[model samples]
Target: MIFIYIIVAILLLIGLLLLDFSLGKKNHRKNVRFLDFESTTGDYQIYTAGDPLFEDLFQDLRHAKKKIDMMFFIIKTDEISRELLEILKQKAEEGLQVRLLLDRIGSYRINSKVIKELNQSGVEFAFSEKPKFPYFFYRSQRRNHRKITIIDGDVGYIGGFNVGREYLGKDAELGNWRDYHLRLLGDIVQHLQSTFFDDWYLATGHHDEEPVPTETEGEKWIEIAATDGVQLEDVFESLICQAKEEVFIGTPYFIPSERLFKCLTDALERGVNVKVIVPMKADHPLVKEAGLPYMMRLIDAGGEVYMFDQGFYHAKVVIVDQQLCDIGTANFDRRSLFLNKEVNTIIHNPRFVMDLRLAFLKDVQDSEPLNDHLIQLFTIRTKIKIGIARFFRPLL
Candidate 1:
């Protein structure tokens, strides 16, 4: 009798969780905000190394004349991250109007005491996507995955790299972090600035005026695609559908939606060369396992897949036929497609696109081809992880 009672209680708890999860998603859909800005002219420099990226960014932070606004999905509570926060604090103390927004779940390691100190220091720190009532479980899973920084309304930074010692290639297990970031100085900075303010409004319920648009020397054009937990899958699908010759995808995670998978296969049928690269090892549990099925399907369809062995390949990039390129926070995964706020920049310049493709090919040269032997290396434990991961794919 007690065993039967226990089973009933477990079922009841699961039912309640499902109810909350469903309701949370429904509520989120009602408040969805999608912003697609037209292509604007900008000058950009790409950064693949962490130390140099932060070095230039920190220098820019110190040279800020007016205001500093920053947002990141994750900022670890390590020495490097603390150094960043200290810089922000000093800028704020100097009356530079420093505002920092962080995803609640991603930066949960930042304790309340630290938040209090940042606020006390005039940093105007706030957490986005706080897990609220009625569906805390589901709400917690939805994240703001954008990593952008706007300085003095002139320079802007966007891409996959986040603040952590690991991101600086300090992790013993995940040696030599590999990623991409863009430093922008041009009219395009205004668009990123506007997006940052919009997110800031969502988090704090406060509105601030935007700065004047800055002029650029470069003539290259770029478009901004910002999604609020919706539309990213369709965006990537459209990009892939337009590919005439080839498509190169690089992401840390590769769990694709059914529609996306079909689109890739269709591209393959059309003689488009589709190549994807994921990290050889996973930094998170179950993520690599969840992607195996999709990887296998792509391989079966004559598409190519590579496992980046040089380091954890965290670059979220897509290059189509050397004509277009996208670089930003959105991954080729469901979390970026349907569960997180993401931002990506679409570049139409052939020169920039080719440059990115070259760098991608270099990374490919450092990676190992995913073949039968690699698949055979999956042990029983991995098989179990794959089974569990498939069951929880959406949340992954």
Candidate 2:
């Protein structure tokens, strides 16, 4: 009788595992969606410095007509953030609709008093996930990693420069930070606004109708690709599968999914030039350790990878065939691809792509070519770390 009971338990466990696997597959298929680029209808400018990006943001806020909705992963207490807060407080006082959303883990160091002040001053703000029931689970894991700013429902800013002096290359320890931030104008700002409210709605129950931008028509086609958990990986996988001739990539992290690895290798097999650039020194040592295997895999498959020697390369930029480009917050890692709320732009403009390619060329000039010998130099401890990190890659 005991043996019969054990057999029944084993069968039930196998059935449960199959059920879970089936749901995961279905959920992945249900999550990815893309907008077709009819034409380039937007005017966009890419910024690489925090100083310039903040200046433009402040200037827009000075002339903001209706609303300012912002979301970010990191909101450090730097001069830039302080000035931004002061201006936002002033703008809210002027009866403008202003809202801010930040990741609970990313902005964990932010003081509650500052938050209270913002609240009392009528500047609406909230963390992406609060420490309450149902939300606390995976609150730290599924972070809001996107950095986006939309002003007056007409203009938008997207890409990697978070609120800090390091982003502007002011930190002595980490000098000359390189990243990409784009200024967007046109109907696409409406899509950016929708992305913001998607999080705002969850954070604050903001059920208000989406605001319609009053901007003039644009000259090119721009589509926003934003997702949270299980979908972003597919976005990049599709992007890689569609590449032709050439592909340039920049990011701080690189832990490609199995599907992504296959797509990149396949792109190379089709006679495409695939260039991947990552930081020399990662913020998380474990992250760097986790990615070495994939980096070697790409190199072994006839792709080129580089390590930026200037400073921490935090920009997530992808330029394909000098005709299609994507710039925004998603990195080529498990966190950005599968566990975070990310926003990226799919742009189809040859002229813009050319400029982006130029920027990438400049960065390549400053980076060191990566090879298998370099990866093999890591200490045994690091190898152990890589193994452990790989075990957790799906959740990292």
Candidate 3:
């Protein structure tokens, strides 16, 4: 009996060690391919609806063979929105594994009828955790800011596009909302599928089987990194630090953490030509207020900052050294850094980065430079509000 006990203990120890080793390997694997969007996914389709991309996404949904997993921050009820919802319901009724996760805050305005309809249709759905009480204090800040859809574990879509009529240019007020969405193909879809599964399990307490590999011939390397919970590995921070010559960034919001702010200032001090473009009229008023002081700091530090005048600038992108770029749903703010679940793809190809640079230049033509006079004109009341907002910036 004593000998058997010793052997069992030894076996358990070995098993734990093996488990740790496997997890480490998964975390450190070097299968990441960094191709620019054009070179990475060759002969791929581009859509600017009423264009092919929009139609292709729907067509992909219509032809899903095995499964469809989707996660979004918001899902509004509009014409195009309802059509997509109905298609999802049809797919679920057809015995496909359709999973949907939506942020409670972003979709708070969605009608209960839509929720009931989806549930009755056998479509699995979950609302991310809502604060029990004191809702404004806790739940109001944290958001699941990822927009992703994976089909058959072979094709994936990620970027700033959300599911709403406005996103499709169908809303009267928000008809011309400019945004971006990317279609991805290749081995990277597995990572996207897994990411969706992880969020699904957290929301619905169910897990799908591991995705099977889909065969595709490509040399474009891609890797996705997302941040959630309190523990994150700061992949965005590392990407920013890797910039050597130029860093071009665009976002709808700009309240960055102190560490990130300092990093940008240090990079500029080291002679990097750092440029950031944000909107002059933000969709969120408080975010705009919180960004002013930081924008002034960046300007004083010799960083070039532009406030886009074109209708709400809702893109979140970062191009580093004109060789690597990241596009996704994360804004450069405290909310995105610590509160929200954000997804970003790091691409290491020059052609893709150059294309993004061209887009940025076109946007700059419509942007107004951040000048010292603007910073000096803040009224006392506005300054007070900004101070309070900055004090609670982390919670936001």
Global lDDT of each candidate: 0.91, 0.82, 0.74
Compute the lDDT for candidate 3: 0.74
Q: Report how far residue 320 has shifted in candidate 1, in Å.
A: 0.2
Who is ahead in TM-score, 1 or 3? 1
lDDT of 3 by residue, 1-396 (tens): 999999999999867655654443343233221212222332122233434556888999999988888988988776777888999999999999887888888888666778889988888888874544333344455577888898887788888878776676565644455666778887777767777777777777787787668565445656677666232236657767887898888988888878888889888977888888988775665787888888889998999889887566778888888888878788888777766777777776788778878888888898898898777777898798898787666655
lDDT of 1 by residue, 292-354 (tens): 999998999999999999878999999999999999999899889889999999988999898
Q: Each model's number of backbone clashes?
A: 0, 8, 4
Off by over 4 Å in 2: 1-40, 131-137
lDDT of 3 at 226: 66
Model 2 worst lDDT window (10 residues): 31-40
The segments of candidate 1 whose C-alpha lies over 4 angstroms from its true place after superposition are 215-217
Poorest 10 consecutive residues by lDDT, candidate 3: 31-40
Q: Estimate each model's TM-score.
A: 0.97, 0.89, 0.83
The candidate that achieves the highest TM-score relative to the unseen native structure: 1
The most accurate candidate by lDDT is 1
Q: Rate residue 61 of model 3 by lDDT.
A: 96
Total backbone clashes of model 3?
Answer: 4
lDDT of 2 by residue, 274-357 (tens): 999998887775888888898888999999999999988998988889998889998888878766778888898898899889
